[model samples]
Target: MFDADWPHRLHSAEQVRALDAQIIAAGTPGFALMQRAAAACWRALRKQFGEVGALTVLAGSGNNAGDGYLIALLAQQAGWQVQLYWLSEPAGLRGDAQLAVQAAQAAGVAMQAFDQQAEANGVLVDALLGTGLSGEVRAPYRAAIEWLNQQTNPCLAVDIPSGLCADSGAVLGAAVQADITVTFIGLKLGLFTGAGPEYVGTLVFADLQAGETAQTAPSVAQVLTSDTVPRLPPRSAACHKGQLGHVLIVGGDLGMGGAVLLAAEAALRLGAGMVSVATRAEHVAPLLARLPEVMVKAMRSAADLQPLLARASVVVLGPGLGQSAWGISLASAVAASDVAQVWDADALNLLAAGTLRAPQAPWLITPHPGEAARLLAISSAAVQAGRPQALARLCGRYPATVLLKGVGSLLAEQGSAVSCCVHGHPAMAGPGLGDVLSGAVAALWAQGLSALEALQLAVWLHARAGEQLGAQGRGLAASDLIAVMRRLLEEHAPCRT
Candidate 1:
């Protein structure tokens, strides 16, 4: 479950700026909004670190710096020792920022020019850069960010961590690694994806009471949470296994039998009526030994897969399908079938290599950054630098719903807003996880959810399961998530009414 009040809509930096202007235009004074933002930041800092009795505020020339100046005034008024360092000249500030600096000065908060030798005392506050950053960080600001990061003291970021791209989450040269980040108005899309997760320590959102103005603002994406994810409806008492659809998992080359087995087990556990595995002959014995309910078939060639494909409602392709002739032939056969499909692992690699054409039926492709890079013809670094862009490109290239899997997994279809899953943990970083996800997606689709709906539900379920199991720390096996996911799925969507 997730916090319902936590905003699900994610916006670009530009959209947030527009929302701010709308709020000010709707009669909230710009100065008043700035004060609210400062107060929110002050409260978050105190809550996160307790009353440190001393504050270090780093200010630049933007409105973000204005928040910092007002925060220094708050600390000063509360009888705390405060040090204010300005990365930019105070004389260059205008409008609300100018008013903020004057207020701080009048309040007797000491201001000093920032220098390389400046030491951070108490809780270091990062206010040097904000959402306007489009290029790599430069000169004095970059120096300030580096210095802030080097400090061992507790640090709070104002609005966003300086030098981190608010649009793409790309670290602009160097970004401040804060212990807490207090953001305002709308949640920026960057704070949840790409390098954003690594740089944004603990995120606190304060709307500054933008209220109706924020609700009407257009958003570029939606974050997946308990309130937003799709749920399966309860089945009737008359329902039978035949009423639920069949899922065919096709993969598991020579030594990679475990990948297909994982997928088949996940599909079976997630409520698919019938789960079939068409992997290598060597895998059949082990697959049945583990999951006898699955109709395990030993495939000698692509021809052997046609009968299974004909009978299946959905096919999950490419868990451990190797690139060898045996694997490629099977992939080609699956591509020709009209069944709904979930493409993953070596199947995606084969698709990227042009060994098989993109499927004509309703399908979903789950690719991590490396596999996505292959599909997009770009370096994996390029994909990570702009994950949303890559996701869009993948959607544009394929007719199927595209799921770019990684931290903050993104899912999208043609002409739909991107959905982001921010629930997974680092302990999920292991093999066979993607295979399990592929099976989950196929299972949901087989149960009659539209491709996009199935993808949305499956990604959330998988991530939430990983997050729950990840609490035990490292050594999280991929198989460990299957039972947890099954339990969570039933909790969200009961089997009987």
Candidate 2:
């Protein structure tokens, strides 16, 4: 049995197709697959609303429509009033889909052609489109999607809500805002990243008994969870400070000293063996008073950072890193260093300005939507619309593992795969979370995890911390993640061999 405890993460359209092929190859006929899907939808409907309600299944021409017809037929048998609005002529459906229509008719399913006058006031089962769609959603379907969104009642979408790109979760033009989405076969990557989370309410996945075969399909993307989170080696009573790795945070030019300081303290709290801050000479005194454990260096130039950089196991560059000459000088020096690094905030801006080239060693770049847009030279909307694709593109471009933060944060690296973190809370909307995440990632990298491993783990841990803090309600501060960070590192850290 699969680990039922794990969150059913999102999958990409390609993953779904692979699952479809696997099911077909496993001796289940294509039409039989359609019937199985329909049954799954019916079971989901009953599980959500029992037998005493009315349902309106909005269907179209593909197998997605077949699933809708089957759901309506089941509801009709259970003595619930059911209605199906076919966006295409029922006679136009071919093969398995047509079979589903005939089955629904024999069972007295009330089916009608789509009309602008149709009432959208009841529980909606959206099977208008599945993961097959690409490009923009046109005309009457767009109008139908809009009408569905305006509905006051809850909507349980079949597979995916219509108009959502199953590969990236971006709305083609408009999409049904579902309260719950029951998806079969493989999970769609689009359902968790970008606009996926907002459009696909509470998601449920049914693999249709495909088991190991279900997992065999190469996923187009992945979602980060406890499974992908890197486990730090467990701390022992015998373990010494030297056993953990040192993390050096570089940035905090002039007025922006607090950013690097925050990152340094965060690294220390996150279990770094030692934390150091290499920043402007003026910020040293205040930084020392705030975190005495942190090593504070008053640096005059990149030459001043050389000795400090040499001793560090991981370098976190960018928090409050300005675009000034001083920032450029330090960033250039960092680019030449062989230390593993986590680049965020201002360092990213510097890279975008073409002042710095790709570094000599492994690095992780954590960019929010706008920063990602700047780095990729694309519109922020485009980045947000196809986050998985954007993340993959970035990974190929920089050859660095990247964490594209926003909504469902995505992590990707060239030659590996893309993963999404679904654990964040809205209370994490405040500033400084990114800094904390960079520190955590740097600390993990210092402790010997691969760049990709560090990025995925940091993203998951940050989200888990937010979830912990958000339990109290919204408006959680970045500092609140520290306590949970300490406890969680202790709890989930892996045992050293």
Which candidate tops lDDT? 1
What's the C-alpha lDDT at position 257 in model 1?
97
The TM-score of predicted model 2 comes to 0.94
RMSD for all candidates, in order, please.
1.0, 2.3
In model 2, where do residues sit more than 4 Å from their true spots? 1-10, 50-52, 235-238, 494-497
CA lDDT, candidate 2, residue 406:
88
Candidate 1 TM-score, true structure as reference: 0.99
Off by over 4 Å in 1: none
Provide the lowest-lDDT 10-residue window in model 2.
1-10
